[model samples]
Target: FPQRYAHSLFVLRYRTLALKELQVASRKGARNLCSVLVKTIAEQVWAMEHPQYTESRKEPVDGSMVGIQMGKTKVFLRSRAFQQLESLRNAKMIDAAILVQSRMRVFIARSIYICVCSSI
Candidate 1:
């Protein structure tokens, strides 16, 4: 039981460290495919690779991505810097929604036209 408890504590610590690394990467303009290099011990590296502690299933709303690339002695964390305002993000999303709706309308109209021509 003690061994398991120690392992659990290590996992939590490593998870927190990973999150902090991602935050630092995002702040430091960690753009492109690969970014911040996080130094970790062997046990921490193992924890970072663990399925339960490694992957973040839900994406954060700020458009930054959390991805990890393990190296020989460091973990590379990739994330985008968040520099835009909330209003700007909302505007961009609204534009995207409009574009999608317009495309869908066009598709529906074309399908209806095809159906009518076939019937005639």
Candidate 2:
């Protein structure tokens, strides 16, 4: 029982650290993906800690609002930085599109293009 308790505490601490890393990455201009991932992970952790709430599978709007407010207070990511990251993401998307189109043209005879750009 003591070993299990220690393991649980270690897991919780690891998750807390992972969340902090995600917040830092988001502030460093990984806006959309990082923020969404962080929120989902946080909600999941909250649900796990509160088993009673798990049965409902519904997040309280006020709870989320409060969480958002708390997150804002803890980490401030400037709008300009977010916009810059967005622009970079957009550019990568455009490049991916171009690559896909080129691959399509090349594989036109085969009628199938399997170009996969993993860096989104």
Candidate 3:
């Protein structure tokens, strides 16, 4: 289930590239397609899990940064920072919802057009 979910997310994010590869593979009967997909997913997951340690990531210049802060006993954020973070997250959610809705509408419209054309 997790793999399927991840694959769907990956394909959505890289729709053009994924579609091109899929078309080519379908036409050519690529034998290593599964290995390529597994490798790509593993690389993407690893990149997310272990972001490279750059100079900016090494330390924040200011003490009052607006992100997650970890302490010896607990993890916490300032109220203002938390509010800002929540708003940012909500914005991303809305954007993703909009994208999904637009895609579904396009799919439905295309299917309806095909049906009408085929009947004629």
Candidate 4:
């Protein structure tokens, strides 16, 4: 169930990319492909900020900026792409919501998000 929900969100997240990778075939088609690239990027960043969380008491994704560490592949390091993908996977939450219903829920969610952001 979670996997299917994630796939749907991924489809939504990169609907154009998945389409382009499978169907896009011309210069005009490529234009829309760019939109997917851009949106995927933006969503990736947004998802990073709002990662998957649960109501359980298990250890959560650290909510602090401490112990932060990042690096790339070098003579003794790692690949940049690999690191970025890892970060995105850890951040881009595509199936965080288990149940979604009604416009009011949507409105309140968005409102809270905005309120939190404004506070920052």
- Cα RMSD for candidates in order: 16.5, 16.1, 13.5, 17.2
Per-prediction TM-score, please?
Answer: 0.34, 0.31, 0.46, 0.24
Candidate that would win on TM-score: 3
User: What's the residue-level lDDT of 28 in candidate 1?
Assistant: 48
Q: How many backbone overlaps does candidate 1 show? A: 0
Off by over 4 Å in 3: 1-63
Instruction: For candidate 1, write residues 23-112 as lDDT tens digits.
Output: 555444433112232232222433434558445534322212223334433333342211112233455568879999999999999999
Candidate 3, 1-120: lDDT as tens digits: 111223333334333323444555554433333323333333333333346733234432231333333333333445554454345446667888999999999999999999999999
Off by over 4 Å in 1: 1-84
Candidates ranked, most accurate by TM-score first: 3, 1, 2, 4
lDDT for residue 88 in candidate 1, whole number 0-100? 32
Off by over 4 Å in 4: 1-28, 52-120
- Which scores better on lDDT, 2 or 4? 2
Cα misplacement distance, residue 7 of candidate 3 (Å): 25
Report the C-alpha lDDT of model 4 over 76-108, residue by residue, as the tens digit. 112432344345544434333323345569889
Report the CA-based lDDT of candidate 2 relative to the real structure.
0.42
Model 2 alpha-carbon miss at residue 9, Å: 27
